[model samples]
Target: MRFFRAAYAVAWKDVLLELRRKETFTAMFFFSLLVLLMFNFTLNLDRTQVLSLAPGLLWLAITFTGVLGLGKGFLAERENECMDGLILSPVPRGAIFLG
Candidate 1:
């Protein structure tokens, strides 16, 4: 219960910050668009090939976008030097890692 609370707090902080600044949102939007465009243009797949490759391509986009989101969050925290503060907090390290 306490663990979840702390994690929620941390996650909420990120969410609020993102809502205020929208850096992560904007970056993620463009990143995903670029990824999809790249995949669409580079892959000239027919219906049969599409069935074989679509799942992997979908996962690739998901993974890339997820990575970009995490990177943006870390970058924001690093710029503000908030990461050290998080490390020193009483919250579980796993919560911080996750949030």
Candidate 2:
């Protein structure tokens, strides 16, 4: 219960921060859009080929965006010393990992 509470708290904090800033969301949106545009121009694929490739391209964009967002979030936390505070908190290691 305690672990879950800590994880929830961390997650809520991150959600609130993200809602206020929106930097990650905006970057990911543009990056995914650019990737789709690039594929459209570079592939010159017919409709059938595009349909087949769409799933792969979508997953690629999602995976990369998640990586980029996580990296940026962690970097920002580190820069602000929030990561250190989390580390020093009494929360269990697993809870921190979940967070």
TM-score of each: 0.83, 0.89
Q: Write the per-residue lDDT of candidate 1 for residues 12-85, one digit (tens) a residue.
A: 99889889977678888888889978998998978899888888888898899999888887888999999899
lDDT of 1 at 77: 92
Error of 2 at 61 (Å): 0.8
Q: Name the runs in model 2 displaced over 4 angstroms.
A: none
Single out the weakest 10-residue window by summed lDDT for candidate 1.
21-30
lDDT, residue 46, candidate 2: 91
Tens digits of lDDT, candidate 2, 1-99: 999999989988888877887878899789888877887898888999999999998888788778888888888788899978988989987888897
Error of 2 at 90 (Å): 1.1
Ten-residue segment with the worst summed lDDT in candidate 2?
15-24
What RMSD, rounded to one decimal, does every model reach? Answer: 1.7, 1.3
